[model samples]
Target: MSLLFLLVAWSATVLSCALLCRAALAAARALPPAPEAAGDIAPDPAAADRHASGLTLYEMAYLSGGPHRLADVVLVLMAQKRRLLLADTGWATVVDPVGTDAVERAALTAIGPEGQRHIPAVRDALVGDAAVRRVADRLETQGLAQPAAVRPGIGGAVRLVKGSALVTLLSAVATYWTAAPGADSGQVLIWFTVPQILTLGLWAVARFELHPYSDWATVAGERRLPATTGSRDAPDAPGTPPGSLITLALRGPTALTDPSLRAALHSSGA
Candidate 1:
């Protein structure tokens, strides 16, 4: 490669790699502190009770698996309560028109005034319900979940990093093609590999750090979830049955331990 071409290639590599690092670091720093940062501080007994009391199983379902899981939990619970009928052939018919909470009301409305709807359709409709958004908003406000707005920021940063990697690759290819014959193409390739390696390394580290940024639950909220697998034990909320609490903790159609109910949910794509 000509001396000028080599300089340009290195400059592009360096600039792209630097930009990737900067974007990744900025996204990481913008995250809230570790969930356990306040662990050393003891909470007041009265306040702890109040906090515990305020967290219903519906909220827990949202924390465990986001809106879809919350919808599943509500549907199964309604079935268990005889407020809805779930047929093994993949249908849901409302047995009770009245709903005791916003999530239930949303599910009911999704089922429509006709009182019947496909289970998957109801679940899909409920996922975007205002009631479901309110549930997310509440959890975000309580620091139990990441804010919806924060997710797009990190997502956009990651996309930019990927774009930078692509730019580096294309620049390397162009430089390789433009080099004069008898130039050490292998050496040129090695020089280009440095930025590729840097980009891959940064992506690996970023993935490790950001793996826990899931759609639902911060670390603190995850810590509070009852073991949903292979266990049915969980505390019940007022006016909520123990069975309903168990179903909510399980978080989705998999929680439908009854064979018929599970079949019904699965058939409907739940």
Candidate 2:
């Protein structure tokens, strides 16, 4: 290939690779941290009461599940506490406007003008409500729902890599243009590809190892939460009773026939 063509070709590939790598790295680094628990709560053979880590069911749902889960928790709690009603048709009727807590108040507001509406409708309506935000903010303050922030180091590294690639490409272009026609590019592509691939590989390894962010559960919560996986062993924690509120929290609406859970899960549409 002509030296100029080769120079441009290789620089283009290098620039593309650098930009793609930086974009991927930036996305990975920007992932939000998972919702966290106050502490390792009642796991295993301990009594159910022993599992209380100062977090109520609402807190547990928030810590392990996120906003929709919190909404689910509130709905079920309201029904159980006789503050709300869920119809058989997935319609949620607000039984009482006066809620004992902020979350309940949020749900009450979320179910606004509701003689009955599908569960998903309620969730959509509630998405950006101030009361919902307050619950999330409260959880964050309690060390539960940790959000992601822009990372200067990652951003700087991305900029540096991209800048270096652009500068090197510019230098190669200048040399090629200033030289005589028909100069050989030789194996310069190999020189560039090897290091670029290595950088991406290293970055992939680091990204996979660190962060591990999730909106549902923190690293600790992911390990501790009771799962319904059909592993040969028992759940890491104990099982919930068929009709218990915890069953709904851990297993979703189908686990329990509670009208409230069905109403919440369906209404929230999450």
Candidate 3:
């Protein structure tokens, strides 16, 4: 009877946890997009033309939030004529462009055998954006520096697994206590403690997976470009011919951090 009770309790705990995780994920998916700050630059018109011409480049920088500090840069190249969007980042791309630039920059910077080739045109185009400049300035003023690349740590994972084990063990203990003697008074305490421990353990695992990193430097310097009207469709849109190319060279950190620059990258399908 005692063994059966333990088995049942364990099953219930596992089921409950699974349901909780599913619910949490669903809630997260339903969340509204992050609020955009005032004065945020809209996507650039030039990006559309560039995209149509199969000439798009993307660079992204990662910054540490807290507890762990690291940085990375990712780059992506798009070939509009070929209907190909080559992403250097580790993540799988569907249609969404969120965090795509950062991932691409990191991958490009991580290329071991390839020598650094500065593309003046790409840099110049990025520098023309206002948004990128803002972000770069904020990062520099915050004293954030490029972080050395290293393999992710296992400490966080191990701690989480141990915590999960502890929660299961505690739940089992509660079942035994309730069945063995007059322990009804402690049921609430045990239930709350189990959930709390499990929650913390899961949070640790999530943090480890989403480890923070910073980029080496911004690719462009601050510069302003006048907005112009051009093609409205995506550069890679079906049946659209390649457009004329206009390339610029960007230099300095501020250019890369500018908010306008970031917006341009997104508009260009980078």
Candidate 4:
């Protein structure tokens, strides 16, 4: 009966770990899609001219009646722009080239040894105008160019899932096997516990390697509105939208009372 219980516990723990790892992988892949620049209500001809002059204006504007969560949306938009430019404009070609061994060696020397050698293939694809058009079409279809924000809670949840995987694995091994401390069971437990303990210790030693706050700050920075030469207080001034979808959903006096709405407002600096 004890063995059966141990086996069941071990199985459950392993299953849980697997689930956590899956969740983390999914979260990593599910980063918010890039934000589409709203159709310039009045196209600034100068904006196009500026681009021609090699000046890029990364603007942040609050959509009328949209969510005030500027930070998350800004980051997504910046990432999106980079993806579009890199994946479509052949920037990769200038940085990395394909086919020629000499070119590859030169690139490796410039980018350092850790650079991905496969990047050259991606650059080659980008250089083809047809490929660029196809990639743009795919981005539109996938809604990857749409503006969306990532929430802090969601980010935290992803991190938790990643951390829990190891914990679950350890718990599984501990729950299983009947060997006593002095017996074979004890030996197996020691083997399992030692590695995890060491890992935990290493994590503590390298705690500074983790940069959760900086990551959050980076996301926030991406969303920051550029300073305008004109008035800062104007309604049309560049800023995050005043209200989010969640805020609009909770109509009337209850809007402030809704927990989710309140949380969104707090995080978004609305």
**Each candidate's lDDT (Cα)?**
0.66, 0.53, 0.33, 0.32
> Candidate 3's residue-wise lDDT over 89-199, tens digit each?
222222322233432233233332242323332333344334344443333332232222211222233344445556556655665666746645354445545545665
For model 1, give the 10-residue run with minimal summed lDDT. Answer: 42-51
Q: Which candidate achieves the best lDDT against the true structure?
A: 1
lDDT tens per residue, model 4, 1-270: 334544544454444445434533443454444433435133433234222212112112221111222222222222233321122221221333222322222333433344332333432322333422332233223332212232233335434433643664545455454435545454444444443444444344324322231122222222232332222233322342344222221121123443543443344333
On TM-score, the leading prediction is 1
Write one digit per residue (lDDT tens) for candidate 1, span 111-161. 999999999899899999988887676666556676654554444555555
TM-scores, each model vs. reference? 0.61, 0.52, 0.23, 0.26
Task: Give candidate 4 regions above 4 Å deviation.
Answer: 1-17, 24-29, 32-184, 190-270
RMSD of each: 7.7, 9.6, 16.1, 18.9
Question: For model 2, what is the C-alpha lDDT against the true structure?
Answer: 0.53
- Whichever of 1 and 3 has more TM-score, that candidate is 1
Instruction: Give the local distance difference test score of model 1.
Output: 0.66
Clashes found in each candidate (C-alpha, N, C closer than 3 A): 0, 5, 38, 4
All candidates in order of TM-score, best leading: 1, 2, 4, 3
lDDT of 2 by residue, 182-221 (tens): 7554455445444445445544653454333344443344
2 versus 4: better TM-score goes to: 2
